[model samples]
Target: MSPLQQPGAAGPVFALVPVAFPAYLHHDALVDADREVDRIGAALAHLGASIRHWPLEPESRTEANAKARMQSWASREHDLPHSMLAWIGHGAANQDSGWLAAYDTAATIVRRGISVDTVAGPVSDEWLERSGDEGAWSIVLIQACGAGTFAKRLIANLLGKPRDPQRLILIGVGSEGAAYLGAVGDALEEMLEKGFSDNDDSITLADFAYRLRAYLGRRVGADLVVHEFAPDGGTPLRRSPVVPGGVTAPVNVYHELRAFLERQPPDVRGHFVPKAQGAELSELAWYFVGRSRERGRVAGWLKDTACGMLVVTGGAGSGKSALLGNVVVHSNTRLRDLLVDAGFIVALPDAEQPPPEVFDGVIHLAGMTTADLVRRLAEVAGINPAARAAADLDALVKALSERTLTVLLDAMDEAQEPAVIAGSVLRRIAALPAVRVVVGTRPSVHDPQRRNPVTELLDALGAGPTTSVLWVPRDTEATEEYVRLRLNGARKAGRLRATATAVADAAATVAGNGEFLFARLAVHEILARPRILAPKQAKALAELLGKDQRELFAAAVTRLSAVSATFDPLMEALALSRGRGLPRSDGIWATVATALTSGRAVTEGDIDQLLDAAAPYILLDVEDGQSVYRLSHHNFREHFESRLAASA
Candidate 1:
């Protein structure tokens, strides 16, 4: 079967028809149009898209001829499930009109060029509407000077015909701006190359548009205007792997993992997350320090080939996830150095040993079930997650047996079915001889009566090493280091009036026996209101320190509420997402905000401001092909829920 017609394929299949009109009788010929078309066609073709080029013959370059050819092509190929129709050449626009120049065209007049109505009129309307109704998507890529005007005219034309604009996606350049030679083609190639480099299986229209605009703005000093009327950021354009069987090369794996980490929200990336310039003086890297003993223990366990699993248990905000995240991001190289420094002789891998492939796996498990875990594992192993669970598990095990694999799984305590994950999926994976697994979770969950998943996991591991992250009394040194670093940073950023050591001492005094999370909050509070550190404000500082974790959180919420009226509703909407996250799409967020606010007017600006204010508490990442906003941690959600309950 043709790949496009295959049954139950993993992603969308595309067919591209690139039409180029390079020469014009009464205008300067588009010297690079043919080459640009070829570049774009080749890029799409490499992604398994069927490509058909229509380069107007010298003898048949008239506008009338072009129209007939497009009409005929549409009649034959309009039934395609996903299609791209690209026109590359001259485009002209005036105050109220736009036209794509045919080879014989002279100017913006419809008599000399193909008008918007001519392209989407009697020949293509029926096909577009019918195909769209059947869930098919069509993208129109017009690379011309006034392409933006063309898009507007095309949209108006469709609307006048009473057609659903959602049937198509339109990509064009600015209405009044000029499109430089090779700009569109180069942008497309770069976008595809990035997706390939990241090991992404597909790129959605919205994602493509996002990248295109960024590329053009950065590289060509041009503008890329896109309108996606289709659902869910328009149809996804799937890309076939350059390598066979979709297996990633070792280098690509590193790039892919790095890209994955970059995509994670700041909080999830832990101490490595970058902070905005206070002269790079406020770098968050300072937040992570003095976990030397824990690092050494984990490294020692990793060096032991006999040990297949290591469990790191800690209370909330005890930095369990941060430690594991550091390891995953840096990979085994940093761990090996740490081990060496700790006086353990680290051996190089033998030539016969397989190359190590590290998978970040799943770092957050708050909403995951056993099935979700299996599917995620399959994805990490480069197997088809859509396959039957048993088949996928077998494939995963077989794949792991052939190579050395290191997997990081965090937040087991947050998973919906923690027991099942700990007792079944993780237990089984840890049994694989060539695999090394590290898991992070709390010592126990809220329900003390039930057997904790950590206990279950430990029981299943038998003799595997376990590490615990204790409360402040044990982690005082680390907390003090963190405070000192943050205060020094504040001084450098000119946010503090006092000396770093003095302020650090004051902050530490207020933090007392609080955990890292509490210390972090306390530091922020002190920085926000530096006067609280004065000797005269000792009682105020004491009052601030008196509040526990929950109280600190409530205070943060109160401050956030003061930022915007939409704060509570936005938080509620995110909580309703159940950790899935709310899309960054304006339409989606507008609908959500409107409903939550009971029809109070909320503009996109309002939403943007709300997101900015909530940045410290929420996570931003791409999920399902679009950027989404998620609560940074489950604790925030729990706190919000408790507040809601109290009000009730």
Candidate 2:
């Protein structure tokens, strides 16, 4: 079999081909040409690359010799998955084309010692276009003057070819820019070291380009140009000799989790309450307070050697997800302090003991299947998700056995198959050695005639010594604090025309039942119409305060009906979306809205106005570079669907 079809290859293979010319016939010689080549070659070799330097002898640096050597190297390494070509020498460019000066390049070529001929021995842009395989990832690094012009011509050439799956990246200095010898090499080495220390298995070319540009800008204040063709995400340059443990630090995965959560809408993730739209996961830390006792319980669970799993059960919107999100986003120091304060692990001198283990993996189960969960876990664990062996659950469990880590799985009740996830998936994962599992979900309801999914899940887990359940109760104080904070901000912003005493009274009454979801909706209603705070509207405020989540949603819909004629159709469209929200771009929202409204000629402007009127009930987010809209809460969708059913 060919190398491209080779089975069981561990990772991508990298090949480095460098060529440098120090002496030119008519141009000034480069004294550090060989040194520049050596520096770059060393950096690439550190990443496990096979290096091939052209022109073994200084006398053979002519254009004919260089072309032959490059052609031979390409013939041998064409099937390799990744290759980089580095050119360090003088470059000349005109308006339309560019060329690299070879050792024998001259202003005028003299043939037979008498006849003056055209310039010869200069490698033109066409030579580059004819070299290298288009099927493999090809990276070109040019460190010569006018390299940017050469890169532009090469980019234009490749743009005319048929696009391939692999990418071609050209990183070069500006057209008239000059680069100091060893600068590129030093920057690359530093970037690799930092990435490895952070537990990155591979460095993407995009990231490398950014780092290189920043480094050069700070050091020499020069602009580095980069051109990419047939781009397919970020192409990673694999590190040589993988880390021995095959385990990623929890902090790295925590960073990934934070990024994942930020990309999701606040309501879908249940990490944010109402009126805090567009708040990132990092900002949620400010709103996280009064969960000390629950955090202590979690810490104790983590410290317990015998307990393998801790299930956190609470009613809807009782702060289960927010607590978990807080834990995931905490800094290393803060997480360590939480464990030390909870008495789970004692603080010691930095030299005396290593820091305690924080959460290593966190996955939200909404819309995730068994395969999706497995893939996510494998990725966070530093395992190759595409490997055939990773597809099997047992194989994955064995792979994870090599590392000691804790993972948090949130919103189990929201999963596509909650029973399979909680029973089979979580059970197997929790059974692994040195692995701790934390799960968050709603309380199980008992059903005599039908099989209760949560009950079955709990039964599957059993009341074993390794299993523990922590019930989440209403936090009246925390709810009150949240209310006070939000209302005070509204009052300051002139959105609420209530006095300090009135605000305090409203906070107390709203948080009296300790229902966080209800309080959030109630505050939203009050803010929507500040006139409700008037003396004559006391009964209206009292009525609003007395309503539950369903009643509040119904009232909001009634108010929306007075605001927009398309409110019912809009709610129906969002309800029909379920987990996969509707994109607001490319006429998708218009098409769906028009269809739902029985061909009422819905326009983009109408959709925008309706969305504005129904902002509280809507969750707007960006998915795959497009704006998406969904009902803010699953309960809200259920209410809409139930209303539709009753009317039917």
Candidate 3:
């Protein structure tokens, strides 16, 4: 029976198959493959695909059997003619090299000219041409590094057919040195399954392609090698039928690179969420998980407070930046859209650092000193810096505040200037009418007297939950959903090779450290090279840490040291374990806390307190809570414990 004709073959008949090689060789690749399966499954479900999944290899360690399984699947054809897609999760451009490389099987199939259509690359050109010769509807998507360059050849073949040649689209991601394999694969599959999409009448395939290139270029801070085979007037493609409103989202929204010391834009929408360990935070994790609703509440309060001071605090790696990104970016988009919708001047605040000469509306990256903030606001609002004396700055501040204005301050803790002075200036600015100000930071440095000083100055303000507002640590459902979405995206792009379980397990392992930071970083690393960790590397890490959970945690914790210069791993360890009671000695407590917190989890004392509170069971001395201790959860403890050993 044609697989497409199976029970649920209703909506778009889509097949998302991730290629695994010679028996599951790359563990990281396997993990990546698993993500692809889940994602493809979810997307197909969303698009309404009656799906049939077949794993190339079983979970057992036997290689020969797995190879047989792989061969069987490759030869197996669908009973019905439907949209067929496969992800070449792992392979080298060269047929001879790499651990999981299956160049021979793939190459042999191409050489023999077995019949199959709708092929995407990461498979060689030789195979694609043979498939084309079979006269089957072909769309070849490549996940390999340089697959983009092959588009012309594919297009040439399709042009010979009676059908529209436009059915074939090639996308690429990666560097100029290689073919545009990733982008081409991603775009081609999206185009074929969804059809051309764009809401704006002005948008086209060419426009979409250009935008994709532009967005990718902007994100990576570099240009993409987008060469056109047959321009075909590159019409603006419509939005996918699945999503309403059809307004095209930027193709490469997540591509970000560090520029100069300018203020970074806030990312409230969690643009980076898809790349994290799991979508939502796990409650069992040490930190509190937060939600978008909490973010809205805190932001609403910031607007209402009208008083100058605000502070947000949390432990290190608790997602201060992620939250700030959402609050700032989302609000700005909202405000800008509102203005545009209202026919007001669509004046966008410079996302880069604010210049001395102020602008129409205000949006500032956190970390600006109060003095600089005030001066810039005053300058932008047409306040005459020449006429206003230093003291008269308050007069100008009040005048400007009376006008329609909004303020956003991110990374308050990272502010380079004095906190007290910045706080006072903020207070004065908040008191002005028609002013809305939002300030975000880690919770440690908050001091009413030193920061705000005035009663009711920040009374209307509220704290955004670090976990929920920025990172949801315990929401397994959300995490799973997120995992599915991201990995599905990866699979669609053809970079993944395993199945759903592999993706879920990898995410779970990364989440074991139970921190959002690690999960995100791991995803980024995985996407950079979609493959399972080699057994050697995985084993090396395991030898150092033990279980996957522990390894993730220790690696995450260790990573914190790299962020802040102040991390004293020993100090962090001692502080976290303090609840168990004083360890045998003060030196031990200090040593352990310093070792743990100092590395990355905690830096300042207040943050240390929060981190310690998050993992109460870890404390050895619960009674007086004066002694050092460790997490009771074997997974958490073992993870950190291994880190201690690894560091040694």
Identify the runs in model 1 with alpha carbons over 4 angstroms from their true place.
1-167, 170-203, 206-286, 334-362, 381-406, 431-436, 447-474, 494-498, 525-543, 585-590, 601-607, 621-628
Off by over 4 Å in 2: 1-283, 305-307, 331-357, 388-391, 445-457, 566-568, 584-590, 601-629
TM-score per candidate, chains pooled: 0.59, 0.53, 0.33
Q: Candidate 1, clashing residue pairs?
A: none
Best by lDDT: 2
Of the pair 2 and 3, which is ahead by TM-score? 2
**Model 1 worst lDDT run, 10 consecutive residues:** 274-283
Per-residue accuracy of model 1 over 1-648 as CA lDDT, tens digit each = 011221224433566776677777777777777788777766665455666666557546677877766665565453456677777777777877778887677654433567787877732553464453455566678887777778777777666665455646677765554766687767667555542332344565565555555555454453455666654644466554322112111232233334444543433333222111000111122246666667656555665544277778766766676565544423334333433454432333342112232443434565677777777677666665456355455666667676665666776876777777877777677777677767776656562234644455445434533332322123777777777777776788787777655677765774466767677667766776667767777787788778876687677778777877777777777776766666544346546866878667554445556654554565544334344556666676777777668888
TM-score of model number 3:
0.33
Each prediction's Cα lDDT score?
A: 0.59, 0.59, 0.37
Tens-digit lDDT track of model 2 for 1-648? 001111223543667777777777766778787877776666666455666666466556877766665555444444455677777777656565556666776653222111101111112232244345444456667766666666666656555545422365677764553645566777666544432321233455654555555455444454466766543554465444222112111222223333443444333233222111112221134445566777767766665553388888777767787666555544245433544554434453333222243566666565467776777677667787464335667767887788776777876765667777777778877877777888887654222224544455456554666778887788988888878877877899888888887888888988895467777777778888887777788898898888777788889889887886677777778777764567544356556867877668555445556655665566543333233566666667778778879988
